[model samples]
Target chain A: MLLPSRFSRMLEVVSAMIMDLLGIPPQVLFGQLLIGLINGAFYALLSLGLAVIFGMMNVINFTHGAQYMLGAFVTWMLLAYLGIGYWAALVLAPIVVGLFGIVIERTMLKRLYHLDHLYGLLLTFGIALIVEGMFRYWYGVSGQRYAIPAELTGGYLLSFMFLPTYRAWVLVVSIVVCFGTWYAIERTRLGAYLRAATENPTLVRAFGINVPLMITLTYGFGVALAGIAGVLAAPIYQLTPLMGQNLIIVVFAVVVIGGMGSILGAIITGYALGLLEGLTKVFYPEAANIVIFVVMAVVLLIRPAGLFGREK
Target chain B: MPDAAGSATATAPAPAPGPRPVALAVQDLNAYYGDSHVLHGVDFSVHEGEVVTLLGRNGVGKTTTLRSIMGIVPRRAGSVRFQGDELIRLPSDHIARRGIAYCPEERGIFASLNVLENLLLPPVVRPGGMSLEQIYQLFPHLAERRRTQGTRLSGGEQQMLAIGRILRTGARFLLLDEPTEGLAPVIIDMIGKSIRTLKGLGFTMLLVEQNFRFAQTVADRHVVMEDGRVVDTIDNADLDRRMEDIKAYLGV
Candidate 1:
């Protein structure tokens, strides 16, 4: 301890300061960790959809944020307008948005495949603007409260923290859905076709598979995933029309860190980064906003292809 | 210039006997890459059970001619008739459904997929393709590494898998682009033997090869392409007489 260099001594002092700040009472630490995990679940779910859609069609899906907002909006409309509860809206909202996604692909996105990648990104950006604009005009950018379903209304008192039953349900269901999607795309025969089509649609099509239709369906599925996440998020967050606006940039960073087109990477990185974000809030609240971007820069410096992206 | 190898083929039976039916027929096939014309009025045909080779130098539209048949490369104007049906208007997959299989130059193997998955992926185009057992028997090395990812196979093994993938499609007509390319001599010999086996099993092939020697061994007929058009057609029996023409066009 007496023989350390000046730089090493400085590093130790800084870490010691960090450790002291990070050392929290169990209640606060556990609660924050759970919050981070919940955020990570949303991140993984959103980024997984982005990766899937990007893999098949090479589209960046700028409308993902809009789709997420639409999920909450759809859920709200179902509950307020039609008196539909959260349980049924959870199942229906995503399907509606997914069908909208299919229509977008068939009418707009399909025409852009032969052109530059920027065209697709720009078109989706425009669509997102239109969707969010329409919602803002009517809803006035205010937060809408979604009542948690009766089944998931209570909180669980764990030894370390008070875990809201709905938040726990969201975490568990998101993990299940994310893994289910990964399994469908990685393990099943249909997944094999999807992966192959992503690599070489021409070759896959040559084998009598309807690759174009599959691409449309894949876009639909990705949008549906975004919608599902939105539905889950409605109860936890104040359901603002602008909720997805800021969250998307963070989700995009998560996708970049995880590696675009790498499913397992996306899932793992999403949760891990969310947990890190949570820890940052407890240890260094001042650096919380830009923490993911800093990690992204470091990861990029080491591996330009991304954490799991294959360098082409 | 007629080598000693020509004698064995000369003495053997014609590659396709008794009123050979045309499996594919291309007429005035014109293709373009954007504004640049690639194939200019190219015409060729492969008969039932015949192994036809399209020989040309690099960048001389040899590969384009094969892609034109598969409809992978759109033709500016021409007719591609497969099994008495017009193929020029059909989509690429529709063309494949007509019992024509294409093996692209890159082998087009999915690196993410295993050998068995790759082999089983392509839908059988017709009913005459080699069975999985037959494919395993033909390339035991493939069977040995069935669970290995497609691109993980040795170049020769991948080539065999590429060829074997289409054979399982039951497609009687196979478009193979440079089957001997970048392969070791031993692999070339094995590939030549495999082509002979396919020929024996009545597979019709349209091969595009810069490897003239490999072409001579498997091709029942040679169609020499220049720039884009069919410049010369040398039946196996007549190649010796046309050696000067082949040499001049292909620079072989």
Candidate 2:
């Protein structure tokens, strides 16, 4: 009887500290986690594109944020100017951005292949700045709002919290896309050619594969992934000229933590770091923004190659 | 410069009765590595259904000759004719499409792919290449470790996989560079037996070798090189009589 009373007293003290001192209920914590997962969906998508591009071309592709912003702008322009719907924009936006990426590869990026990687990075960074400047000039800093589709406008009431239908759809679709890409690159016959080319392009060429063409298509595919992420993000986030700027930095951090040029690493670390950031927000709100960077530093110190990456 | 030794040997057939058509002919081929020249006026020829070995001391352009033939070298001039088609201007992929497969000295096996994936990685440029079953039958060790990563394979198994991969590409003309470079004695014997088996299957091959004994076991002729020049061509039948000459040329 004395032991039971003492245990109850300890539990009561802990509960009081959690409720009164912390001021965040379990429901609120769970809600932030769901929101984090939603953000993570986009991170996984964007970083996966970066990893694929880096894996194949050995180019850092600093223009990825601009490409993501282009995806969102294309979706908005299609709906506003051409009266196209969200469903069509989802498919069309990526294709348009992917083609643009192809042009960039063929005209500018190909010339820098023989040079050091820093040149490619500088060139792409400049391109990103120019593209962002043009968009900002066209459309001012204030963001345009995009309404959610009719089919996914409402919220679903759960026992713990209210979940938006669009956010839930984002989580599901991004996970599917991420895993689908992993399967394609890891399990398919074409994937074998890509993997072989990645290892030794000269040998693959001697085997009669057009490795340059494969590189172009890979860059296009990676850019298209960013476009898809942008379209998925459109309904939730505002359509702004500077929208992709801040997000891209975090995505880069995710890539660095995951390991450069590691596809599965990008996807896994993206989602995991997003969740970690959410937990940080619950416990220490001021450190939420820097939690991912701290994790990145720790991971770098522990394993420079990353959790899933192999050393080159 | 014409290959005078090669021309003289063509008149007297040692292995076969009649003269088979030339499958590959290199004429005055000169290649450079940036400002450094590697091959200068190197000349040789391999007849159809024949296994020819390019024998030389280290850095005498044996590997460069093979790479130049495959169009892998950065700057190579002069003519490389394969089956009446001039390959001097063609890119490596186009040359491969025209039926010349190269197994490099380093044995370029993709570590990312499994053994089976590595075996099946090269696209079939022609219809007459070996099927999967035939390749598996040829290299039983490969079939056993089909799911193992390419680099995880032993040296002998990797060599077999490299040769088997080219066989599946339908390229009857193979340029094998040092296939027996770093293998155990038993594995080298197996490779020699496989080369003989492939010869019986009517494959034409040009090989580069540092091991003269290994080359003598599989080759129909040995073309000796000195400083990127083909100085002599000796038939395999005359190999025993010319062993001292070869040792001098190879500086062994």
Candidate 3:
């Protein structure tokens, strides 16, 4: 073997030390961080929906992932079949998906209300399987890419990081949606009624709330939020039928780690865990796949109710 | 000794007769749980401003009657008319919006919500809602624990919170089940006083109680049930004479 040059060896050692100390190059690190934030945004939105459904309806909504995939597919069909643009699809997707949710609630979910929570979970799981299977049969496992809209196609270079404009828009839109939902549930008069019904539907009905309608609407709204998240995610990820499947598992973990105690808690835990996963990617690439699960295990050990969950 | 007090009043003549303007009317009401028929052809009516107590032992259908009125349980056949409006076909929430309120035996308070949130919940409608000061006046203990979560409240405080919450809804009629169950004597006394105060305010009440002594002090009329049917309807004037029968039926 040829002897290595002393100066080249010295340079290699310095760069390796720098990489170890700084975790990763600034561009790679910030890029991953940005991606993490994007992932966090979706996580926050999806988990918020799950928490809302769980709180008021006491349904795990295993169909949530399927509904989210339906949102993306609906948007695609709107564009391809109806010549609708992204903006219109953004508004139409949720309404269509929400109405679908309402129909499900009226027919299938209504029957399971008096039964065990497991039955609801099992029913929704079967729904998820049916939905996913149908989509796979039509679209196949290979994902189709969605072109970024002309208006959102540019990018901005900041320091060493180049941020895509569409990604930034996704970040901004998701935060607003998440906070808007949180405010509706936490601060509004309607929210009070929702909360009351969740606690004691019988008493709330006596107060004239029309609880069955409220239950249907609440489930619809929660599903609509997931649908919104799906639309936002369509351009960033491959529009595959399997897209929402993996995301939902992470979101469930985020919900458990957050304790599903408060809406705000679910959102915050989602983003925070997402950022931690990003950091893990830079420092220990091997752990990136399950950093969220690891964090969930740690949280359960420390506080079984979750970080924000109240101890009974 | 309490039985003697009831008999002393029993000999008095029945108070003024004839149906007062009906506040709530239940005709041939029948209800069931799965295959078990719990309420059968139950008939009763409460006049405006009247305090009617449905008194019976644990399983004699007093609670079921109140639940059926509120549409909490499924009614197989019947007409429940509240203030001349048909309630049997209406959903529970719609029935509630018509100005009927229920305080369940479980004292269903939202344990996660603070006392003030619980009180603030029902009176969301404008113009005739109960204010924090009014609820405070009714149950000062609730006022003290306004910021406290519902689970932290004592049983008496939870009962007060439950009643106090319904009062805020501007509901003209109240359905209260076992308001004094599992409470200390002092707390029960406070609840008794609150009921009297509420009666003084012109609120119509259907109180279900196993505590005959407590019911005796507050009820204007008593309807006793056995086997999902009303066995006797005693005016306050006749409460004492029926004590032996009530004691035997209630097994108290």
lDDT of 1: 0.87
Instruction: Report the C-alpha displacement of residue B190, candidate 2, in angstroms.
Output: 0.4
Model 2 chain A poorest ten-residue lDDT run: A1-10
Q: List, in order, the clash count of every candidate structure.
A: 1, 0, 4
lDDT of 2 by residue, A187-252 (tens): 999989988888899999999999999999999999999999989988888789888998999999
Per-residue CA lDDT of model 3 for B1-252, tens digit only, reads 112111222222233478669899899888898899998888988998788999888898889898888887864568889989998887777777788888999988886577888887775432464666777777889988888988799999999999998877778789999999999989998788778767666678999999988888788888889899887888876879887887887887
Better of 1 and 3 by TM-score: 1
Model 1 stretches with alpha carbons more than 4 Å out: A1-23, B1-17
lDDT of 2 by residue, B168-245 (tens): 888999999999998999999878877876776778989999999999888989999989899999989899999899
Cα lDDT for residue B251, model 3? 87
Could you tell me which 10 consecutive residues in candidate 3 chain A have the lowest summed lDDT?
A1-10
* Candidate 1 docking class: medium
Worst 10 residues of 2 chain B by lDDT: B1-10
User: Which runs in model 2 stand beyond 4 Å of their true positions?
Assistant: A1-23, B1-16
Q: DockQ, in order, for the candidates?
A: 0.57, 0.76, 0.40
On lDDT, the leading prediction is: 2
Compute the lDDT of residue B66 as modeled in candidate 1: 86
**The CA-based lDDT of model 3 is what?**
0.83
